[model samples]
Target: MRHQIASVDADHTSYLYEWKLNGRWNKLGATVNSDFVPMKPGSAEEFILEHYWAITGEAMLTRWNTRWSMCHGV
Candidate 1:
């Protein structure tokens, strides 16, 4: 699987990302899971993120990074 960061919000609260699967983009769909809160400076927030991939009538789960780094310049 391959992915690219499509976009990120100005406050870095939301990230728009996309993934390529089976030679296509967003074929299985993508999910962005988080608390949906802005990060504080020099601090980390608790986040629950997961990515679901559908393959051959089965669902496969992929965990995202629990810690999201605050963007220095957005």
Candidate 2:
């Protein structure tokens, strides 16, 4: 599986990045210009986590819980 990050920039431009992951993509989220900063080595997770919350209006923990429960039937 892969985790994909997609966003639209301030100029209405779009970008995407993909990373391998062990889980499926279901409760995937989207980010916008305000949600992200410059991406550098070793900062992918931090950037995604920050943008995830900014876009979802939920904490990372809560979003993960909800996604897990919904997808895993837990």
Candidate 3:
């Protein structure tokens, strides 16, 4: 319920007075070197990429009234 959002500087420190809130104090004045590169998780990427396929399969199964039982190895 924040009426106004405070901006953070390049150092990642919020202008709000509570620096220790949500571990902000620990991450303050930190820097990421040039070697820092971002990449997506493989499982997440696969799930996101195959979302349409999952939906299509569900639609097809529903239309055909197919029943599926999945096996989980204990």
- Can you tell me which runs of candidate 3 are displaced by over 4 Å? 1-51, 54-62
Q: Root-mean-square deviation of each candidate, in angstroms?
A: 14.2, 12.4, 18.2
Q: Residue 59 of model 2: what lDDT?
A: 42
Clash pairs, model 3 backbone:
none
Candidate 2 accuracy as TM-score: 0.21
- Candidates in order have lDDT scores of 0.34, 0.38, 0.31
Better model by lDDT, 1 or 2?
A: 2
Each model's TM-score?
Answer: 0.20, 0.21, 0.18
**lDDT winner, 2 or 3:** 2
Off by over 4 Å in 1: 1-12, 27-74
- For model 2, the stretches where C-alpha displacement exceeds 4 angstroms are 11-25, 33-74
Per-residue accuracy of model 3 over 1-74 as CA lDDT, tens digit each? 12222334442322212134453332222222223233334554345445655643433322221123322221
Winning model by lDDT: 2
Question: Given candidate 3, what's the lDDT at residue 30?
Answer: 21
Clashes of each: 0, 0, 0
True-vs-predicted CA distance for residue 49, candidate 1, Å = 10
TM-score winner among the candidates?
2
Query: How much is the lDDT of residue 20 in candidate 2?
Result: 35
Q: Write the per-residue lDDT of candidate 1 for residues 1-74, one digit (tens) a residue.
A: 33345334433233334455565545222334543444433332212121222232111232332434332212
